[model samples]
Target: MTDTDIGYRATRRTVLPASLRLRYRLTPWWVKVIVVYLLARLASTVMLVALASVQGANPWTGAHPGYFDYASIWDGRWYDIVAEAGYPKSLPIGADGTVQQNAWAFLPAYPFLARAVMTVTFLPWSPAAVLVSFGFGLGAALVFYRLMALRLPGSTSLFATVIFCAGPTSPLFQLAYAESMYLFFLMLALYLLLKRRYWWMLAPVLVMAFTRPSGLAFALAMGFHVVYRWVVRRRDEFPVRERVASIVVMLVAGVSGIAWPAIAGLVTGVPDAYTATELSWRADYIGHVHLVPFAPWIQAADWWFGLFLQTSPWLGYITLVTVLALFGIWMFAPSVRRLGVDLRFWSVAYALYLLAVFFPQSSTFRLLAPMSPLAGAIAQPKSRTYRVVIVVLCLALQWGWLLVCWGVDGLDWSPP
Candidate 1:
């Protein structure tokens, strides 16, 4: 059977009876995405509950955490605080002439959604946040599946979806985090851009800007597109008006990418309000630094060295080797050629952006969740045994990551 046929049969076997399955054989591809989501949810929930069962005081609330409690720990706590109390009017500063960690550090999109959901349904912030994540996570998966189908067959796309869900940081999608919502907007923006719906892409781009600092990746990709059309392709094919319109759209996207931080700075009366709050988390580094270009590499080096030098120096080398390997893949992998120029450019730029701005920590991999679409570009295994082994390894690592990094009582030391 073809890969598409295999996917259809697997979906049919899940819900429809043998007699009725034949009648519904032409089910929409999205139903299969939903099936994949349900399966991933089940696996993640089981693993999360297993860890929560061994919990002490939940760091976020200082209460004995159940499953919901575990989901809202770490950065989720800050999101909850923002949702419940809202950001302060003035920028918070510390005694040493530095910014302090505050709600301004987090983007407001996810918390606003959670608060709106809570108002509509009369649920607490914890469950409401998870519900928002679950719904948006499903939508993101559906859009992601469609995007993958543009380049992959049904079975391979399904495998990519599975890999996205079973990624080590992917469980955050089922929690009270903004990863899912941000991804929903990010992928939608990319998909719209890929379809060449230039003006229509602005809506998601605007929403994405308020979701995370990484929204700039979209603008960067569009800027590359402009350079390709005007310079590389020499602008000979399209009409002048069409070319001008596309350029306008890209310029709008570029500004909207940094609109959130700019607006926040203006409102808070601090020209660098967002940067200050973000840097506050690393105040212990014993140095003054601006959020200028290439700062995160130095910050990541310092953080990782401090973390591993006393514990296990080998871990630092392993981390370096892993990053270099992924960089090599982004640069030269033949499979990446199939992802088209837009996604390929976006993925590499996004990776470099993360390395430059984000400090490496426990939540560092979680920040990379936006690159889940790259799973579609991964070379597939030729043998069933290899495929099975890869899936098993992915799921095992996810569970292991949660238990080791997320479940401990004092994990508040690092962002989740």
Candidate 2:
């Protein structure tokens, strides 16, 4: 038989054995889902345990020391306070009964969820919150796997899961932070967008807005996607009514996402509450001190270069080069552009986010974490050498942030 016929026959016969057919029929969908879910969970657990062990064994402790002790280091304490009681009139008093001025410091959704969990389960808020974060992170990884599987082969999807779940930044999942939850919403939004399920995408986009201000960026990015499609596709192919509906959906999604923060600000009468809370602590930080046009340059430097080197100097230098290299590859490689993914849209959104946070007085690393997944998705390399370099750099930057979080003297940029 010719090669084509032989291949075709092989494909048909592969499914023919009665025993093999029975095995396939007997396999439950839930069983497969559970197995993949457990795999991701197991990977996250391992990383968290490793982080906890290192912190527990370390001799020199910083401001807040312990496995997840850093929770109280920056915005973490604020979240805990918010969970115990609603946003206080003013910051809570210390153990010594000293009152502080920053009461509207915490973000709303995470702490609110933590408070609900604490009230319902009667468990300590810290551990309970961390557990919830962990579960959400695992779910996010699974969603990422599902999304990637749509665009890549099964093996690549599995590799992407490993890169996402077990990579250096996995420790974020163990903390009482909102990265995991935000990521869960992000993945859900992306899945809905890919499936063209516009209404489903709106729900998670709304949840994301409450989780963090950057959630609005996702909605805007989706809006951009809709516009790009309309601009590129032939006008005659899409009816005017359908085009109008698409525009309406994008507007509703974008407005709804921003509406949450606007409502929160109005209720609190803190017009710039989000920005104010973020910058309150770092008001004197170099990036925030500059103000206006100059602030963007300083912030970009701090985020793209400063934070890494300042926190972990050696890794910082390596990461700086890696960042440049990845950007270089993306700009110069035609193959990467031709890969059919909207890498440019994500890259632009990320740039806007970086600029938006420059003067916000938050740690560049924490502010930049949400964009890492998008970066990873778009940084796929065409050549073997490019792949190796990109992967190494990504892992280095990710792990470097983990060390910075653990080792820095004043590392306190959790999403309160």
Candidate 3:
């Protein structure tokens, strides 16, 4: 029998019925992507539980509750406050209603959603945070998987999803922080844009505007994609009318992302209200040295490069080698270079923008997290021994970083 006939016989002889076998045989590619994404997310949840146990805390309680008992949970407290009440304004001024601080300074999307969920379901914000965390993490994985499958085959795409879920940065997904949500929106926007679903892409881009100031990156990347298509395809995929509408949509998303903080600054009569707070914190904790002429660019580069040393010293050393390897790969691998208007350029650009804007916070590395998919797409072994060594070293370094951060307790929930 031919391969097709032999495969059919094997399926019939298997325990699964013919209908079930056919169903599995014909499972849609996207459904398989979702399954892999969910499995990776479930694995991440298990890792979180294990991390919490090692830290002598209950992962189920999460960061907010853990904060009450441990000072390490300070970052979780900010998210809690943002979730429960809107951002806090400064206390009451004189009877004349003078404002002291702008509570509205905090971005509204995450906290607003958190509060809405609590109001509707009577679920505490802590558990709600966890639920949102899980949802966003899974959503991000699914989007990333789809994005990878656009450029990679099934096995490579699945491996990329796993790496994203279990990489050293995975702990961020378990925290009350906004990385999970930010990445989810980002990946969704990218996926929709790749699929040429411009209108659907606009919705997530709009929501992303409220998630973080960095949401603008999504719109900008989409704009780049449009320009790329115009140049290369010459196909009126986005007609003149649609293109005009998309421009308007991008403007709205970009403005809304920075609206709250901008408004807070105006209300408080301090142009640098939020920026000052972040700068002060960075200087005090991270020893950030401001540079002249190109302060933002310098800070951004410092931040990206700093990730190797700041997060985990051991990982830092491993990352040094990994960086070298990456540089070599990028130089030599024509396939990776030709992957085209996908994540590689977008991620590097976003990372640059984040670094320039945020002054090199260690968390900035997470902005490049999407590159993990690209990494998996290009991962191949020229020789058996070489593949085994690289895989073991990379996984070991990633796990070691995860363990150290988890053992220290509450790294994600609180600021460094």
Candidate 4:
């Protein structure tokens, strides 16, 4: 990126009051990140509280539940169960003989971490789980800043961090969920991979694998990283040792990605324990369909098309193809390319992973949060108006997402 494209964090010319501007200029970058995170979380908490005030009694909470109670509902309660009762040895089977929803689907790392916190702090599951998310979210923001700084200017990277913190899903940071913790580990892993710190990457990569279903996507990224390096070896040196390390890491990542499933199957004495549990969540929407690789999107497309448009399902396929084509173009755009090849590789790999296995649903946004490095691309242009517009849209959409997904309508179909 050109110097003109990304100026210093604070310009000599500004509209701010002199004293406040001076204080802002003197503050540390990390401190600024903390302030942004805190302020963002505060805003999200406010939104959640407002929703909680009106929320009617549901399976998870009483009428007009408080902040922690509301946040602890949904997937947070699942994590709480995993932490308290642990996974079942025998899978719960429904009358139809399909696997019923159980603790096996939720990963162990985040909830166990919360359990540790609960032991020491004497806090209940709701508070402890939210604390885990809050703390790790701050960590994620800090690491995200450094990762963006690797390629963009410090100011631009910081702005990108701002975008991330204030993004629509910022509410996840305060909820009793694992997304914030997973993002911390995922971003740290990507940062290490980008720096070619092969050995160091193992820590976050393995941990994040258990934190979320990230192993396969990261392994795919490693594969692409290796090929990209080999293709450009004439300009960028790709040594034998580096290649060996990269290949080994890729294989390890693949193993880590599937490790949880293997463990679930073994312990439960059901060969498809993990996959079946995950599929059970969607059975309510798509019925008891068999799991097929790279087929979920096609099926989801038809399902969604038939549900909404009540017309030809082929239109859905064409729309999916068009979206993929546009996304591919965006991946190669000059602004995104500037973030480096590894970031792009991760984006593509994550996209492919989602396409192969995920059905289009309300949870898709949360799943896509791992590929958020592209925020740097948006924050690159040094236009105050543009930045303000982007941030404003983020804030507005924050409320929109809360209204549509977070708020519990009676028998709600949409979930965040």
Candidate 5:
């Protein structure tokens, strides 16, 4: 017991880790979000490289062969095209007399921003796309964490953010995909609504409408909230100006959601140009115009049921059972209630919208990214052990999903 032990203890107390802890204590919440997002991006990058390095995997290539090639596939390829060449003047008709897949089906917001960054900074398209996503994605994380903290304690909010970053499909945020950009706008719009800044929500709503198809979900939620306040609540509790602001938010959002497709149609001189191009990706590639209400659900049921039935009829039955189980979870889970009315309804409506319009393909996970707000339910549980277990399980599923969906040849069957 002596001078030697005292000297060792004294030296250890002034280590780099301890100093860094002191700095972290002084750091702001937004900076912590950036750090977490960057770390998550690093982890996802490692996973991507490992998956791509597997022997016999299809090269994610068209004009080039490398990581960027993988990043520029499926919807990403369309976005890259729009960024580089810009949209076409007319619909490219196929030999079968139906519309072919073209840039019109894709939205312009992310591509335009990426293009602008490329022009200003001289980065290549791939790097520019990544930069846009990484920057916007970090911003979205900041707002999302703030919103969560508003509803829950700081510790729980931070925990939920970690779980979200480590989610099975969150790798989309790391890629040069538009979901991250779309998420930034969505979160901003929601934050504006939360802060009671109805007017400020307009800009994000318009941008979000051009970013992804889910913009309407936000508009619907805003409109619903407005109606709920005026009709469901006491008349004396509302003000005329607030009601007018609410209506403006609703109308502006609703119009913004439809503006792009309508523009495509007007520019092309084909009323259904946008719808036709979108439907060109379906199972029946040249199906009719956009799906009517409930059609996507029917198509999804038929498609999944038939797919599973090929292996065994019982498997088809199991598919229905799985759906019923999910429905039960949606209806009964505490997470649903914990998200509050706006986010909960938005998640459910957005999920339904995706099911209706999008094929139940591999990229369905990415399409559902807007429902991230629902993940707030994860923060409701008080047990630290439970949160840890959930994060571990999510990461494990993420790795497995990467291996199964990405580590293979003929990768076109699944969208990235």
Candidate 6:
């Protein structure tokens, strides 16, 4: 080839990437967020549709169910029951006298909204549920960008949203679940808190309380935030009125956090109805046991180690402690600290809350989606190679999650 031909080819190659980057930079911020969202949903749709094509007769649907049918499989049925029949006047009791898996375990917010959509659009539970989830997922993406922009540069904030959209549990975004709804409100609440819009924060806080089991975790974050403001009062100037208002909001949130259990107990004659129903799901792995504060993880570890692996349970205990310690240290990393006090405190509080109450299992990854704010720290590094690698890894894990957790493998124990 002539030297001129070689130079022209090199110039064309250089100009192509630069032109694409320029166009991308020129796009509006909201459009960029929506673009990544569409891309993520497209990729997830392909995987779920492929799974549906091969899905055999399961509890919820038959072989070769469509996309909406597949998305509504696992917890969707429970939501449907809630929407159609409402929570039971009497809890379903098993022969063992423990609460059986019932509609009481699910929060009413997502299903209530789905039923509303059904009323308006005349669609069935499956499609209506998917629509509600998708709408909330879209809202979550938009609010998450605004929240991230509060502390990070615009590009970093957008990348964090991308990471969040493509995360393993992101399938929940399109599925018939409450995770998407809860996440939207959670990000909005956090954004309002950071802006010091205390009164405006109450709206999201109340909605989030009824959406999922996140009220207690959010209260803890707010409580720590109050203390943080007081500690840095000299520099940050936490006024007396602001402190009092903050405390009031925190107390109100804490009460709201525990209100569902009380409501469940009152409606049903069975006191502890909510707690019992929740524990029933875990009973599959560890048999029937009373709920104890800060004991679930240890109990779960012993079950996995001693029963499943036939090994010393002490090693499991040691490993759990070590992992928790490492997680605590990770909170102090420079990148994580850059997320600001509200995000950082929320991370620590939520992690401890999960460590105390959650049993480590397949659902654990889905639960971790609440901590997606930490994705900002991961997005902080400006390495193009690293960003591409992480995006690929996220999608790969998405496939793994669908196959291992969401798919109804024979005697499937993992539920997304």
Candidate that beats the other on TM-score, 1 or 4, i.e. the better one: 4
Report per-prediction Cα RMSD to one decimal: 5.8, 7.7, 7.3, 5.8, 3.6, 2.0
| Candidate 6 colliding pairs | none
Per-model lDDT: 0.77, 0.59, 0.59, 0.91, 0.75, 0.90
Writing each residue's lDDT as its tens digit, candidate 1 over 1-416 gives 89999999898887578657665456777887888788888999999988877777654554446778788877888999999998888987668777778898888999998999999999998899999999999999888887887777777877788787677777877898898998998888778767777777778877877887776666677777777667655544555765776677677777876787787788888988887787777665534567766666655654567554554545555677688697766656667777777787788778777766766666777877877878886625456787778778888988877877787656355556
Shift of residue 371 alpha carbon in model 2, Å: 3.4
Off by over 4 Å in 4: 1-23
TM-score for candidate 5, please give it: 0.87
How well is each residue in 315-402 modelled by candidate 3, as lDDT tens digits? 5446545764775567446656544565655655564455456543444455456455466544432455755565455456545655
Per-model TM-score, in order, reads: 0.87, 0.70, 0.71, 0.94, 0.87, 0.96
Candidate 5 positional error at 146, Å: 0.8
Score candidate 4 by lDDT. Answer: 0.91
After TM-score superposition, the amount by which residue 307's alpha carbon in candidate 4 deviates from its true location, in angstroms, is: 2.8
Give candidate 6's total backbone clashes.
Answer: 0
lDDT of 2 by residue, 27-143 (tens): 753344446556644554544445545554222334324455543334566677677766643333345443333536556778788778878888787777877787787788777
- After superposing candidate 1, which stretches have Cα over 4 Å from the reference? 1-25, 62-64, 231-236, 239-242, 285-288, 310-326
The number of the candidate with the highest lDDT is: 4
Output candidate 2 Cα RMSD: 7.7
Candidate 3 clash pair list: 75-414, 88-103, 89-103, 300-355, 303-360
**Model 6: per-residue Cα lDDT at residue 252:** 74
Better of 4 and 5 by TM-score: 4
Clashing pairs in 2: 107-416
Clashing pairs in 4: none
